[model samples]
Structure formats: C-alpha cells, structure tokens
Target: MTAPQPNTAATAKARLFGPGGLRDEYTQLATRGRQSDSESREWSGLSVGHRMAMLLLAGVDGDLADLATRDWRELPGPEREAIKSEVRAAKVAFSRLVSLSGRW
Candidate 1:
C-alpha cells in the first residue's frame, strides 16, 4: 500500500500564531531571561496581551508583539477576515482585563 502524502500547507492558525509566527516571537521575548521550568508554566498561564505587555516592558519591539492581535494579510480574504475577527475579540478581552485590573 502507498503511504498518504503529507499536507504541506500551514493552517491559518499555524501561519499566524504557531511556531515562528508573531505569537511565538512575543512568547520568546516574554520568557527571555527566565531560569526555571516553573516560570515556563507561569508564562503559559498568561494571556496573549499580558505576554505582549511583558515583551514591551522587556524593551522588545512593540510592533512585532502587536502583530499577534492583527490580521494576517498574507492569508486569502475569507480566512483573513475570520482570523481578524477572532483576534479582535482577543484584543477587546485583553483591553477589558487590563482596564479592570487598573481599577483594582
């Protein structure tokens, strides 16, 4: 029997937020200078915007981190629009979380 061919095309989420993507980039920045596995666990618990804020505080490029919450223009129209909507909700949630925290 012949083996099935691998699907080489990256999925929308993988292309936008998986390895080597903007989310990974920000995660790398946020976790920089850390020295323990427990810290990794803690970092994993953080939301996307919190990770972005950590990256900002670490003096990394804010533009790169901001890309996570933006649409992936490289994707075709429908997929792009879908991902954009999802990211928009994430941005709104993050903003509300930050705003609520500030009031505490």
Candidate 2:
C-alpha cells in the first residue's frame, strides 16, 4: 500500500532546490543583504558556471546536482555529452541556469 510518487524530474526539482529546500535556503540567505547594495550578492559557494552546469543537467534529465552533492566524482558519459550538446547548440545558456535556479 504505497502512495504514488512524483516522477524523477519532479521529485528531483522539488527536493533539490524547491522552496524550503537546501539550495533555496542558502540562496535566500545570500540575497537577503543585497537590497541596499550596489553590487549583486554571491550565491551559495557554488560557482555560476558550476551552477549553470547543474541546471543544464537538470533540463536534460541528468543528475548534476547529485554530482555536485557527491562532489562531481564521476558522472556517466552519455549524460555529460547530452548536457554539453545542449549548451553548444545554444538551446540554453548558463544565465538560464541562474534564472531557473532563482525561480523558486
């Protein structure tokens, strides 16, 4: 008698950085002090490019945040290739990652 579960993509997004989730928690904290400052505040220790890589990975049904959580030890080749292809085709951009990551 198990309840139904959301698909992997939905569950992953909901868990990874959704509201009240860990990533959102830090992102919220970092942006809290930037209102009166001229310079934009930085996000959780993750670099913009690395963060971009995560979102790109997410978009393609890959688990980059998982990799990051695991410190990028080793991810599968096809998954990595798919993400790279998406980036190269200009189907998406790194800024999209930041934008989506901030979206909630």
Candidate 3:
C-alpha cells in the first residue's frame, strides 16, 4: 500500500516556497524515507532548492540540461529559428505568471 503523504501536493508545494508547516511535511517524508530505505536524515528544509535538488538527483536534469546547453545554430536555419521563437514565447509566458498571487 502507498504510505500516507503528510500533505497534499497543493498544500505541500505552497508550504515549500513560503512559510507554513513544511517541517511536519518533511518530517513525514523523513519517516517514510527511512522506512523505504531512502535518505531520511539529510533533510535541510523543504525549499524550492530542496525540491529541485531532489529532482536533479533523480536524473530529471538529464534531458532538460542537455537541451538548455544545446547550440540552436546546429539545427537547420528554419527549424532553429522556429525553436528559438517557441522557447522565447514559452519563457515570456512563464515569466508573466511569476508575480501573480494564488494558484493558477
């Protein structure tokens, strides 16, 4: 059976980036981590850094890292420009949402 998550994703994610009850969330994670033979004792805090670090440690950085470092000029001109434009638009859209309050 799946172990209980101390907080739901929405609540935990909110708590992580700001001040709330993420201490208890991480406490529960540590307990489950120990029970599952995972890292439990090394928790510092449940910040975005921790979340990103854990994602990177789990190899989530592989493809995205590769893509980020890729030379756009290596592709055919039309496709390269198209991709650059797409990425630029995506970046703009993402940035626009950064300052809004409450969930999307």
In candidate 2, what are the lDDT values of residues 1-104, reduced to their tens digit?
99887698878887765545666556558887332222112223557566566456546454545544432213345654654565466554655566566856
Ranking by lDDT: 1, 2, 3
Q: Would you list the C-alpha lDDT of every candidate in the order shown?
A: 0.53, 0.51, 0.45
TM-score of 1: 0.28
Give the clashing residue pairs of candidate 2, or none. none
- Model 3 bad stretches (over 4 Å): 1-71, 99-104
Tell me how candidate 3 scores on lDDT: 0.45
Residue-wise C-alpha lDDT for candidate 1, range 1-104, written one tens digit per residue? 99976665656568655646776566557878342255344545667786565444434443745543442332245543454455566677777675567856
* Per-residue lDDT over 1-104 for candidate 3, one digit per residue giving the tens place of the 0 to 100 score: 99887668787676764432565457558787342222222222334454344334333434443433333222235543454455456567768775574575
**Clash count per candidate:** 0, 0, 0
RMSD over all Cα atoms, model 1 = 13.6
Q: Model 2 segments beyond 4 Å from truth?
A: 1-58, 62-64, 70-73, 91-104
The C-alpha TM-scores of every prediction are 0.28, 0.28, 0.25
- Model 1 lowest lDDT segment of ten: 67-76
lDDT head-to-head 1 vs 2, winner: 1
